[model samples]
Target: MWQPFEYAPKNKIIFGKNSLARLGEITEQFTVKRVAIVTDQGIIDTGHVEKAAYYLTQKNITTYTFSDFAQNPTTENVTAGVDFAKEHQIELIIGLGGGSSMDCAKGVNFLLTNGGEMQDYWGYGKAKQKMLPMIGIPTTTGTGSEAQSYALISDSKTHRKMACGDPKASFRVAILDPSLTVTQPTSVMKATGIDAISHAIESAVTKRRNALSASFSLYAWKLLNANFESMLFSPENEEANMGMQMGACYSGMAIENSMLGATHACANPLTKNYGITHGHAIALMLPHVIRYNADHAQDIYEDLCRISGIVIASCAGKALARRIEKIVAATELPTTLSAYGITADAINNLAVEANEEWTAQFNPRIVKYNDFVSLYNKAL
Candidate 1:
């Protein structure tokens, strides 16, 4: 029998070329007067924060913006955001950038309402109190943070990334304005796109995957694989941008239901140790993880290939891995771990850390320390 699963979508998604104009209208639904927009310096530079503030202010809502977080949001950053929100007595929050901004927003909500450190809610559903209603407006086409309840916050001291989640933390609305993504640099586009693609593929065959997540994963893979190259080559194409945005959102939704696998588990340590960008680290590890999981998830891998119109070669897993390699090649990112200056000696430590990542347990195929070591060596 199929595993029993609950399919409840908490976020109402609005997708268009310029749905950002509806931000004020959407905020009004919560009947909140004081609002906080959590974003990044880069997005503020792009004027999206100003545009969002203008819309909210026009509706007679008092607006505040917090952009003190780094690209990988830390617990200290969330604490700082909480202090800022407390000072202003903010009513509602709008996450208005990439994953970092959204995650920082969620992390703030966790503490703003339910007073505690990020580590208190490390696993899931640990918040004992209600969380403030928040909206996610993504300016990038990846990370799918808009569609998730979890906030990936790094610990300040140890630099460990924590996935803190609760039902109350899910976004009330996700505004997908493809136009916002056009302003990103080409390198950002390539990295985030690859990250989204990994989300779709990894979520598809995880141990937690069920019917609901499977549908999302398959469709997201189709959209992402079909449009990734176009989004890179013709960044201004509305159709391509929309496809990538929706694909990334769907990938996030899939992750919400199913979680991820060894690729993310392996990628996290690379980001923490070497400061490798998340997407670039994912690119280096994903193909190897796919091949590793083939013994148990080959059928699922084959399904992804079939849906994306990729003909399987001798092995479905190998074919999918090769396809991902080809997609990575299209970008300027290096495919090998050594290219990032990650030496062979570091593989042992990276493997140990990878084995301990939260996503490691959910990998369809069991991943041990030695297995991670092998995967790292292969990537090297």
Candidate 2:
């Protein structure tokens, strides 16, 4: 029997090369006089921010820029953005960068309109007031923040990742312009690509998986699996870039309905403690988690393998695990926990934190502290 699931997508997604040209017209629909463009300095350097500003300015919409945020986007960053928005009396927000920018935008929207701290809206649907309208233009093919309602903001003091979400937080428009992503550095491409691939795999067989989510995940995996190598090999491959972009967006849609699984649960502690990039950490843990969940998600894993045309080695789970491992190896990202200086002594502590991650309970297979310990050991 299929699991019952709700599907209410609030974001309007426009996809194509140079689709960003529509930004001014889309913002005009909201009839907003002032808009805030939330992004990082790196994106500003890429000139995407300037381009976005030009579009909005053509419509006579004044644009305010906020780039004071780190890669992980701490809660403090959101506060700063909110303060900036307040000063400008921002009528609408535009997130023009990668996931961090989009997440920071949503985080600002949550606190700016609702009048509270980031922690107050940590889980989901905590905001009672209406949020300001927002647009998201992803310059990277990962995180898929444009297609979803959750903001993964971290606590500045404690450094814990918090997922803040609300229906109002969803973007009013998402522009997937493949032209924007091709300029990303090779390192960023590899890390974010792996992260997008992980999203598809992890969301496919979560405890919350449903027919709707399954469809998205399956197609996302197919596109991501087929195009990831091409994108990495030739960053200027527009067709490959488009495939990866849509794949990442579809993965985000899947995650909206099904959530994630043990890979994310295990990867979080690594990122929190070692400052490992989220995608690199995910690369280290995903294969191990895939093997661990084999007993419960074997059929799902097999389906993924068949769809991706991977030869089943021993079983579907193993084949899928090997495929992921091969992809990580190709990227030259570290595949073992020890490669990041994570020692066996750290396993117990890491496992404890992993067991407490919000996604742990959503794994198709139960992941207890001991199980996390074992998974970490295997990765090591």
**Candidate 1 local Cα displacement, residue 55, angstroms:** 1.0
**Clash tally, candidates in order:** 0, 0
lDDT of 1 by residue, 209-294 (tens): 99999999999999999999998999998889999999999999999999999999999999999999999999999999999998
lDDT of 2: 0.93
Report the poorest 10 consecutive residues by lDDT, candidate 2. 2-11
Model 2 Cα lDDT, one tens digit per residue, 1-380:
96776789898999988998889999999999999999988899999999998998899999999999999999899899988999999999999988999999999999999987999998989999999999999999888989899999999998999999999999999999999999898989998999999999999999999999999999999999999999999999999999999999999999999999999999888989999999999999999999999989998998999999999868899889999999998899988888888899999999999989999999999989999999999989
Model 1: lowest-lDDT 10 consecutive positions: 307-316
Off by over 4 Å in 2: none
Best lDDT among the predictions, by candidate number:
1
State each model's C-alpha RMSD to the native: 0.8, 0.7
In candidate 1, which residue ranges exceed 4 Å CA deviation? none
Clashing pairs in 2: none
